[model samples]
Target: MYSWHTQDYLNLAANIQKRNFGALLLHGAANSGRSELTNELIQFALCQSPQDLHACGQCSSCILWREDNHPDIVLLAADNSEERKTLQIKVEQVREVIDFASKSRHLSACKIIHLPDAEQLNISSANALLKVLEEPAPDCIFILQANNINKLLATIKSRCFKYQLTYPAWDDALKLVVENNPDNAEFWLRYFNGEPLFTPPFENHELTQLKATLLKPGIDAIFALSKDLDPKRVGMASLLDFMLKWLSDLFLVKHGNNANYFVSDTSAMQGLAAKINNDKLFALQEDLVFLSRWSEHPLNHKLQFENILFKYQQIYV
Candidate 1:
């Protein structure tokens, strides 16, 4: 846990001191520890041995939270991933939370609803929550966590206090990787797009080979590059994320701000960055970002990627 990143959350906690009807919306990119922080706050609220607002680990509430059985904490995720595929927090879930908020704490001092990935709440669900958020109960506090706040509606957004959780600097994230695997730090750092800390382990050789293909010149090389990764492997999505970031770094450098660019860290990447133009880079990034969101659908990912790559070839050729 990066204790430093929790400062914003701590401040939110402090601001809500004895204020029963407030909301905190925490937004962050993936792997930013939003859920973990919510859990910690839940513990603090329930902890019997709070040493001045901080949870004491040896306390009864801490023991309950540690055992994964906190009655006062209600959590709703997009999907069970273990079973159900409720793509968003449904209106029913919001209604339940509202009802629970109206009642009172059965055991814990405060009732907390930790809504992870809250942006996935559909239109009806957001409306349902808005009703309660506009007039929350005296003993209730809502904390909504999301990766992209733009996906949320303005009405819902206006009702709650907002906080954005930013990722640590690349150097700091890289340091953690170096601490565990001294030799593979740089390797994994590049593979994970400088986010080596939270990325899952996989075969580096595969992505390296794919990067080689993409870096080659000509339309055939571009097509080959897209096909080589197969887009079917479990690691393909991660590979595309890495590739997009690499291209983004180049895109930044091409626009004349190479001073702090990631690609500028290495001479070879910097050379590659020099060959690309900002216009192509911008269009490619937009296309990639669009495809990434749509990729979740039951579409032919290879065909989708090929179409995008073909545009690159048409322009770069």
Candidate 2:
């Protein structure tokens, strides 16, 4: 489905056939279709039809893939699902992968291991895996996916075939949105980090109300929530994520990059945007890593966020 837009990546994959590249790195922001592209490659490697642009979905291998039982294709992420969980890719997961690598494929011609979010691996775990990447088995292919390539080690980076996945143009992403879920603009825009191929549920009346409340004075919203003392930790965390995404959009618009803004008019956020620069905007984005990790605990949420807002105010001035 997403293959039509990934011509360049497919061409690169074809080139690899002529001259085999042991490892390929797929790096991109969230929802930029990096995983989809990896899936395409896996399909091509195991596909019964050997066409440049198309994978025959009718083949036995393709049928197996659709059922999530492709023997040669291994996806070793922290979780099998796409949702980001608050845990590292433990040594046990790597051990399973190692075990899989030890054996040959059940049916396919080549063995392929796709590790999405490889950066989630801890130090010892990553190092142990590095040896496999360094001297991979002759018939094996390793594709590493990372959202923040900078988080990976230089040595690890050097050992792979790499490409950065660029965001599609605004018009292109908008077209994707219309084709899928045309009604839920806000949630999709925020969830995929401005990638339009994403479909996040926005029909939830609670999210709509939460968004409206956030648009009020920032400190006022905080104080009002404090009064209610709602213990819906999940909802509160989602609110924080939504607000941060809005702020990120504002920062982009302030720098004359409104082309990327999913919010129709970012003019109302001018005051907030003018208070920060590119460097500060990047720092604020990094701060979100902490927010995402600590927001589940109510005490940590209040205490940490108070300090975060305080520092943000200081930085704004």
Candidate 3:
């Protein structure tokens, strides 16, 4: 209700108003608007006087939300402010939600417990949350958000209403991205699959240049960007994903098939395909797949990523 995607908002609002569903799961690609929807739904559920599925900003509940002090709404999300070995929605966090559910609503009819990173809930924590879900708290609603629904446990997913919200078509999303950020339209469009907020910031010029370097890789493409490639500052996961796209495109073009990513870079892909063999391509793919799983926290991310680049260079040779 507060953002651009509203069709789901309307339907969800009505569902919330009609009766308590106890649990709901919003699944989609990374950077999809699942978090936004959960935020709106929190307000909608806690609002004393909602209008057509929107919160009344003037109500006490709405006022509390505006002040960032909603008692009935519990949001336990992954902590990303500081570097960690691995991030997760810890068991203690889910326990807090259970405790919150145990108490009466502070300002509304029911409690709204929202977990924005549902997939990050590991076994112990998920089981902790499941205990409450099985008991069925009185008038309590649980909201879960996941980037990939398949990663979630089937039993947990079955307890909640599942909604998949993937990104809109490129043309549709690019318009919004361009409207909000016009200066780096091309870079943003290509980088985020058209998801505006997911685009690397315009100020990250080094990464922008890295994109071009990957397209027309040279003998020292990795060394060229070594100074700016800080695993801490830049998202290594996304970098790996982008690299996979380029490699997959090159592989496809080599096999006389359509490219999966960077589809517009036909000539560049052709050049890359001509230089590399199928075996090398598959090797690169395996390396990327393995690195991506552990890229979140490598002992020496610099050396790890640099090695991938070196491997690519050797493949071309």
- Model 2 C-alpha lDDT per residue in residues 57-176, reported as the tens digit of each score: 888888998899988877777763544445568788787877888897777667888887878877877877888888888778888888888988877889988877767775677677
Clashing pairs in 1: none
Q: What residue runs in model 1 are displaced by over 4 Å at the alpha carbon?
A: 80-86, 166-171, 180-197, 200-202, 217-228, 250-286, 306-311
TM-score of every prediction relative to native: 0.79, 0.73, 0.88
Model 2: runs farther than 4 Å from truth? 79-85, 183-193, 199-237, 245-290, 296-317
The best candidate by TM-score is 3
lDDT against the true structure, per candidate, is: 0.67, 0.67, 0.75
Superposed model 3: Cα runs more than 4 Å off: 1-4, 79-83, 183-187, 201-221, 228-232
Please give the TM-score that candidate 1 achieves against the real structure: 0.79
* Cα error of candidate 3 at position 270, Å: 1.1
Cα error of candidate 3 at position 32, Å: 3.6
lDDT of 3 at 239: 68
Task: Please provide, for model 1 over 187-264, each residue's C-alpha lDDT reduced to its tens digit, 9 standing for 90 to 100.
Answer: 666655555455444455665555565555467766776666667654445645765766765566556655232442
lDDT, residue 212, model 2: 47
Find the candidate with the highest lDDT and give its number.
Answer: 3
Q: Could you tell me the lDDT of residue 260 within candidate 1?
A: 35
Model 2 misses residue 193 by how many Å? 5.2
